[model samples]
Target: MEDKKKILLVDDEESITRTLKLFLDRRGGFEVRTENRGSQAVRVARDFRPDLIVLDVVMPDSDGGAIAQDLGEDPELQSIPIIFLTAIIKEQEIGGHGKAIGGGVHTYLAKPVEPDVLISHIQERLGV
Candidate 1:
């Protein structure tokens, strides 16, 4: 039997996290855990050991990019793929260290993301 895929989803907004978690848990075919603080993301990711992390780039405490950088720097969590969810990106221009989507993100999904699209991206990135 295959192992169940675990996904850690972080967003500062309670409503967004709650709604996303419900849809993700119901149909996303993975164990999804939602965290509402960016500062705690690394700790949760370290403990949860999720195969993928759905990160929000605009949290008030700590931006997702900083969390991503920390996760990338940590050997235990570096291999986990990160997908940035945000509303800050209103343009299509790409720029970053690797220069993709205007910053350091594996993929960017704009705010008000549909449940199906979110699940699809999770499946695609996580190979679930």
Candidate 2:
């Protein structure tokens, strides 16, 4: 059997992480791990070694940008792709389109994202 794609989801909201983890695991053909505390994301990612990361932009502990920077600086983790799921910016603000921000190191999706859209984005980024 082929190895499954690995994904790490970091969100302060336990509900969000739970929902996404369940959805991705059942339907996306991927191994999913989730961390509810933003501060712990890097450590968890280091251990999980996911092929991609789904992050929340604003969290009480640490913002997604800082986490992404930390991951980027790590040679072992730098190649992983990060997609930011956020409500910090309104849907219309980015032309109502999920845009690839941060020079493709990150992609931004509005909060209340549809599961299918999120999975599609992940697949596209992972080239699956």
Candidate 3:
């Protein structure tokens, strides 16, 4: 069987992380890990080495953009794709295809996103 893709979910809300993890786990094709603290995201990512990251934009400790920048600056983690899962924008703003907010390169998905939609985006990002 083909290996499952590894995914790291970085969100400050434990509930969000847990729910998303459960959804991803049940959906199959992915090996999922969750980190509820934004400050710990980079450390966890370094250790877990996920193929992709679903990150929350707002956090009490660290900002998602800063984390993404850190990951991008790191030679070892630079290649990993990141999808910003945020509530700052409405789903309609995504306009069919996800967009890069603030002119950044990473894709952004509005909050309350459907699990199936998230899964499809993950598959698209991973080329699965």
Candidate 4:
């Protein structure tokens, strides 16, 4: 049997993290870990070593961009892909390719995104 992929979800909203973690857990094929505090994201990621990270842009304690920067700077964590989930921009702003921000290097999904769409993105990013 193949090993399940690891995913880290970083969001300030407890409900959002909980809901997403439940949904992904129920779906199977992946092991998910969530961090509600952005300030603790890097620490958790270092310990969990997830293959992918689903991050939120705005958080009261820490900025997602800063976290991403920190991850990118870390040699151990730099290879992991990140998908930004944000309400700051509408779905239309993402364009057809869903690579609106980060100069086409990163994936950004608008808030209120469908579960299937999120799953598809996750699979596509992970090549699963």
Candidate 5:
């Protein structure tokens, strides 16, 4: 066996993190670490060095799209793929998320997401 794919989940809500953490870690073969604030995501990522990140698009101080840009710009963190999760985004607003942060993330997932769906995306993206 090898090291599990580390994942950092950033959300401002505790329930979402708790719920998703269980699914992503147990079934997805991932070591899931979570942050309940958007502002803390970058710092946590620096320390966690997760293979993949699931970020909440709408947060208290900052949004996931902005966080992704910050990570994408850094040479050390750029290669780590991010999946944006949002509740309010309409179908038409999906593609332009890249433009908001001036760059594109690996994938975007909607909020109230099913456990299996999120797990599937994680497996597919991290190849776990």
Candidate 6:
């Protein structure tokens, strides 16, 4: 059998992390790990070594954008794909757009994201 795709989900909300982790693991057929603190993202990413990262934009300790920047600067972690799950931009605001952002690895997905769409994005990115 093929190796299950690994994903690291970083968000400040326990409920959000819990739900997404369960959904992605059970329904999406992927291995999922989560961190509720943005400040710990890089550390956890180094340990988990995820194939992709699902990140939240805003957090109390650290912001997702900053975490992304840190990840990009790290040679071992720079190539990982990051998807921003944010409430800052609504789904309609981007015209249902979910594309990689300017930095060349990060993608954007508005919050309250539907599970199916999220899974589709994950599969598309992983080519699974």
For model 1, the superposed segments whose C-alpha errors exceed 4 Å read 91-105
TM-score, one value per model:
0.87, 0.90, 0.90, 0.91, 0.88, 0.92
Worst 10 residues of 4 by lDDT: 95-104
Candidate with more favorable, higher TM-score: 1 or 4: 4
Q: Any idea what lDDT model 4 has?
A: 0.84
* Candidate 4 C-alpha error for residue 33, in Å: 0.5
RMSD in Å for all candidates = 3.3, 2.1, 2.2, 2.2, 2.5, 1.8
lDDT (C-alpha) at residue 15 in model 6: 98
How does each model score on lDDT?
0.79, 0.86, 0.86, 0.84, 0.81, 0.87
How do the residues 16-69 of candidate 2 rate in per-residue lDDT, one tens digit apiece? Answer: 999889999999989999998999999999898999999999999999988888
Candidate 5 residue lDDT tens string, 1-83? 88888999999999989988987777886899999989989999999999989989899899887888899888889888787
lDDT of 1 at 121: 79
By summed lDDT, which 10 consecutive residues of candidate 1 come out lowest?
Answer: 94-103
Off by over 4 Å in 6: 95-102
- Lowest lDDT sum, 10 consecutive residues, model 2, at 95-104
| Descending-lDDT candidate ranking | 6, 2, 3, 4, 5, 1
Q: For candidate 3, write residues 1-128 as lDDT tens digits.
A: 87789999999899999989998998845899999889999899999999999999899999998898888878888888888898898778865355443344677788888889889888888888
